[model samples]
Structure formats: C-alpha cells, structure tokens
Target: MCDEKQLQTWAKDTLSRREFGAFSGAAALAACTPGEANGTDANTSEASGDVTESSVSFETEDGTMDAFFVHPSGGPSPAVIFWPDIASIREAKRNMARRLAGEGYAVLVVNPYYRDVAGEQFADFAAWIAADGFDAESGFALVAPWREKLDADAIGRDTAAIVEWLDGQDAVDTSRGVGAEGYCMGGPFTVWSTAAVPERVKAAASFHGGGLVRGDDPKSPHNMLDQAQAEYLIAVAQDDDAAAPDDKAAFAEAAEAAGRPAVVEVYEGDHGWTVPDSPAYAQAAAEKAFADKLELYARAL
Candidate 1:
C-alpha cells in the first residue's frame, strides 16, 4: 500500500502544478442546464426521507474491514451493495447510499481498499490517483501492482459475505435478493461481486466502469455475463467509448450472445458524471441514471 503522507504530498503537488481549467475542461463541456432537484434531499424530515447511517466491520481474508451502512428504519427493505470509485469510500458515496435508503432500500457502501485504510480518507487516495494520473498504464504501474498487498480479491469475496450477512439481518428482505451498483473502478468490481455470488444478487449495474475486459485474459469480468443470474445495466460515458470501444462492444455482445437481459445506454456525459463530487458530474445525466438504476432494482430485486 502507498504511504498516506507521501500520497497526500504527491496529490497536492500534482494539483498545484495543473491548471484547474485543464482538469475541469471535460466537465465544463458536459455541464447540465440548471433545474430543480428531482431526488430526495439528504437533510429532510427524518422519517419521510431519512436513512440511518452507521459503521460496521467484517472479516476478510486480509483482516477486518470497515464499511458505511445505511438503511431504512422500518422492516425488511431490499438491500443494495455499492462500491466506490478509485478514491474509495467518501462523503459523496455515503450520501449516495443515504439517498438510496431514503428511496426505501437498505444500502451498504464498502471500502474496497480497506486492507490498508479506514473510511473516507479520499484526499489521500485522490492525491495518489492525481499524481499517478488516471490511465490504465499508470494504474497498472502504480495501483494494480499493490493489489496483492491490499487483498483485492477480498473485495469481491467480502461483498459476497455482506450478502450473506444481509440475508440474516432482520432489516433486510433476503427473499427478494440484493442489487449491486458501482462507478468507475467499482463498476467492474460490482460485476465481479455478482459473479461471485449470483444466487443472492438480482440486479447489477455499472456506471463508467473500467477494466471490464483484460488483454491478458479472455475470461475477464466482461466475459462473466453468462454466469450472471441477475438482470444487468451498463451506462457508458460518451468519451469512454472513444477510448475503449472494443471492450464496450465485447461486453454488450457477450451479454447478448448469452441471452441475458441487459441494456447498454450511452449517456451524454463524461466518465464521473454520476458522482456529484466528481469534476464531470452532469446533474441531468446523474438523475436519469439513478432513476434507471432504481427501476432496475425494483423490477429485479
């Protein structure tokens, strides 16, 4: 794992050197026209649109891991397990979970990087990514090589464990099964988790996910469509298609060939549009995406 202090320093220096315009150029191009907020607010009447927030830890192969848990106060809600982007679990993601819970679902947002750190020290993670730059080559060089030390496999396995735990919880309705959603790196992780325990996941969605297909292996996450027991949705950013057109097609084609119920939508936004804290957040796109995701969970779970 990268040293937290060193990562912070690198991030700060990288941000300092880059002009803000350079970082936000794509976002500026994809900005949504102002409008009313369609989703429930985080700070409203507690019962009407409130979600209880707490922390829970579970044992993984690496060790114990911490995660943010959000759910409704009443009986047995359908559960949704969410994974964060490369920055790991942050306030934005926790808020996302709460909003989903407000919509009447129990949500668990886990820290995939929990092998090394605790909750929401994203500035450090962001600094690491910023200094390293967001590219596959750089990711492998700086990030992927550290996977073993952080027990990356535990991310998928622990997700399955959470599903089992949710099944036993009085607050969750295991009969309906669960839904899984992820963004960016969490996107592929979500699919992998579904494959890990398909019997418990009724729906899976990935937004602007990376690494669906691996060059070195033909049986990557993208090829696991045949193994999915749940309905699937893939939201691809317009810009991302330009870079990984082949992988996107492969994912779609594989799903189709397997006769799975899947829908691939190309949204008019940038890669991080679904995340409000991201530089590329497009309110219009995010709202539509969230609604679509909720509908999928409602039908499948």
Candidate 2:
C-alpha cells in the first residue's frame, strides 16, 4: 500500500536526518551482529538459541510460494504464519522467525510478493531504499503493482494454502491452533488468514499494518472480524495514529460489534519500529510489542 511510503515519510518527519542516520546505522549493525549483543529485543534474543531453519516452498493458487521456516528442536510446536512488510522475506525476517521459533513455535516467514517474484526481493529494507534511489515515492511505486495482487481475498486464499502446508509439516503441531502476525503491508493479511482458516488460526496480530480499516472494502480486516475465530492485537504506529486517529477506535468498535476480543493501541514507536532493519527501530517499543505478541499466543494459541 502507498500508505507504507507515507509511513516512511512520517518517520523522517518525526526524526531529524542525523537521528535517522544513527538509527539506521545501529539497525544495520545489529542485524549484522549475532544474538542480542547489539541491543536487540531481549525476548527475541532469549528465544534465539538453537532453532532450526530452512528455505521451503509450496504450491498456492497464485503460484509457488516460497518461505523461510524455522522451529525449535523439541517436539512439534504451534505454527505461526509470519507475513513480512513491503520489503518481503530477507535475513531480518529470518532472524525474527528464528527468535520466535526459539520460543517454541514453528514459524513460517512468507514472501508476500511471491505471486510476482520468487525468493528474496531485497536483502533488507536498506537494499530496497537504495534500489529505489532513496526516494519514498519511487520505493513504494515499485511495489504498488504487486500490491494490486494482494487484496484481502487473495491473502485469504494464500493463508489457506500456507496453513495446509504448515499442518502437513512434522514440525507443526496440528492439535494446537495456529497464530498469524503481519508487519506493515502484511498486517491486514493476518486477519485475512484467520478469516480463511478460523478453525486453525486462533490468534492474529497486526503491527503497523495499513489498509486494516478500508471502509469501502467489504473484505477489510475490520469487516472480517466476524469471520475470524481468533482474538487480535493491533499495534498502531504513533505517526500512523496521528494521521488516522479514529481508525483505532473504529477497529475497537468493529471488534466489539463482532463479539471478538481485541487490543488496539497506538504504540510509542514510529512506523517500522518493531522491525530491526527499519530506520525507525525502537528497541523498547519493539520489545514491548514482542512481549505482547507472546502473551497473546500463550493465551489464545
């Protein structure tokens, strides 16, 4: 969604160029460093031990879907579908998955742009920015075409296929309900995932996801709550909240009307704060968000 580009602009507006440079430098360094030495989220770091990872793919209605799968060495665990932001799957996402896997969950980090391209589109957010000539508009413009193919219906279909693949894996425990978490562009996809396989996906979380409250779309994430059996956690970016202050309330009202439990809050971090490769990475807020996600999964999954 173009809103993703707006989020980038918002981050720039909130932080001076020098400050952003420092954040980006630190994020890049942290991403390159192993474990939690660079002040990565403590929960994510604690869960980073001894997790197995692999590159895998499965057939979807759109095409072959490629993903990075990771899980603990122990017995089968609850499956978690990770829908990455606009940059698509890369080392940052894989590391995030590994951290979650260490927490005893079988994590699948999906390439949301798989329909248009296979494998990693960018090595990281920095790569994407560099490729786009460091222009926000052009950066999002490159993905705008791909976004057209990722509507709620399409994401729901993909989620169904993904859940089926996860269930068939030895690492995934089918007995326990699945969970889905999406970042940026992937956020609304989590709701679509739950709506597609309500029986399997019992929990969903959206971090700074755009298009969640598409009032005109019948299949908007807010409108699909009744179709989902899962509880939700919607973490809004501070700048995004400032731009659309009523969207959070709208989400709360929609969930209440649908009789679905949800926690919708505007977090202190700017857009992309939860992601390690983003210029807006805020360790404190990202850690809080991760803790909240683990709590949600523990309670619902």
Candidate 3:
C-alpha cells in the first residue's frame, strides 16, 4: 500500500536526508555483515550475545520457504511468526527478529516471496525503491504475481506449515502459544495465521496493515476473527487511518461481535513507520507500537 507519493512526502517533510541515509547505511551494514564463527550460513547470521540466529528453510505445499530464525540461547521460548512487509526478508527484519528474540521469544521472520524468490530480493527499502528508479509502481508490479498467490487461504496453509516447523525446533516451547506479527500487506496474514492454527497462535499484531476490512471478501481479516482464539493489536498508521477512517471502527465492531479482545489505535506515524529502514520511521510511534506488541505477547502468548 506504500506508494511513491508517500515516499516523496516522507522524504520532503518527515525524515530528513541525513537520518534517512543513516538508516539506509545501517541496513546495508546489517545485510552485508558476514556470518559469525558459529553461524549456519555464509550470508545469514545473527548469533550474538544472548541470542542465536541463522538462515533456515522448510518445505511447504507451495515450495521451499526461506526464513530467519532467532531465539534466546538460554532455553526454549514462546514462538512468534513474523511476516515482514513487501520488501521481504532482509537485514532490517533480521534485526527486528533479534530484538524480539532478546525479549525471550523464538522469532521467525519469513520471506513472503519465497514461493517465487529466495533470500532477500532487496537489502533494504532504499534498495527496493532505487531498483525501481523511485517509482513505487514498478516495485508493486514486480511483486504483484507473488502477492496475488498469497491470498488468505494460501497464507493459512503456509501458517500451518510454519507452525509445524516451529514446534519441531528445540528453541521453541511447544507448551506455550505462538504469537504472530505482520506489517503492511503482511498484516492480514497474521489473522489468517491465527485462524489456521488457533490452538497454537494466541496473539496477533498488525502494524499499518492494509486490506484488513475488505468490502466483499468473505475471507478478509476483520471477518475472520470468529475463527481465531487470539487477541489482537491493530496499530493503524495515522495516514492510513485518515484514508479509511472507518476501518478501525469496523475492526473493533467485528472483534466485539466475536467475543475476541482487540486493541485498535491510530499511530502517529505514517505507513511503513515501524520499520527501521523505512523513510517514514518514527522512533516514538514505533516504540509505542513495539511496547503494545510486547504487552499482547506477554498477556496472550
């Protein structure tokens, strides 16, 4: 849902050039960093201090799915399935997984485009935009096919497979419930995940996610909560809320009707704000969403 217009607005008024460059530089560093001595792959490595991470792959009904798995080295922890935004799996997502892992969760950041591509297609959002010559339409065009295949049913199947894989890992605590978090287009996937395996997934958080309240789609996220046994945190970007002012209300109504607990709020940031490598990243808003995410996990997972 992030377009070139939003990118221009962010650059012109939100994030200064220096700050944007700094974030981009940090993303590049993370993406280019070599694997640690005990890392599992040449290009994938997150092992450090209290957490251990590595690139991993598993088979799904669709194809071989690649992901970044990170967890505390101390012991097994509650598992969390993280669905990254359209940029796919990259260093920024890996860093986010590490942060959640440090909070004592076994975090898995999945590449949503693995059905068509493996590893990172772009190292950061900047790279993604640059590759398209600053035209967001091109970036959208590139992923349109892959994105189309990721309907709620398809993501539900993937979620089942991901949960199976996580349960098999020694780093995951099967006794505890799993948590699900997603951004942008990945947001509705969290709802599908909870519905896929309600027995395992207990909490879900959607940040600046789109298409949550599809008009006639019976499988839309707001319409699927009746199938989930999870609580939710829906962090709507301020601009996104402005565009669809009734969506948050719709979500709240749906949750209440289903007897499910949900916290829906319009964040101060714009779309793509929660991601560190995004041009719209706002520290205060991002941190607030993070805190809300942690609270949901703590209470439900």
Computed on alpha carbons, the lDDT of every model, listed in order, comes to 0.68, 0.83, 0.83
Residue lDDT tens for model 3, 175-264 = 999999998988989999999999999999999988889865889888999999999999999888888899899999999999999999
The order of the candidates by lDDT, greatest first, is: 3, 2, 1
**Candidate 2 structure lDDT:** 0.83
For candidate 3, report its TM-score: 0.90
Judging by lDDT, tell me the better candidate of 1 and 2.
Answer: 2
Task: Provide the RMSD of all predictions against the true structure, rounded to 1 decimal.
Answer: 6.5, 4.3, 3.7
Task: Name the lDDT value of residue 185 in candidate 3.
Answer: 85
Model 2, residue pairs in steric clash: none
List the candidates' TM-scores in order.
Answer: 0.78, 0.89, 0.90
Candidate 1, residues 86-113: lDDT per residue as tens digits?
6677556766777788788888888776
- lDDT, residue 270, candidate 1: 75
- Highest TM-score among the candidates is held by which one? 3
- The number of clashing residue pairs in each candidate reads 0, 0, 0
List the candidate 2 regions with Cα displacement exceeding 4 Å.
7-25, 28-49
| Model 1 regions lying over 4 Å from their true place | 1-49, 123-153, 215-218
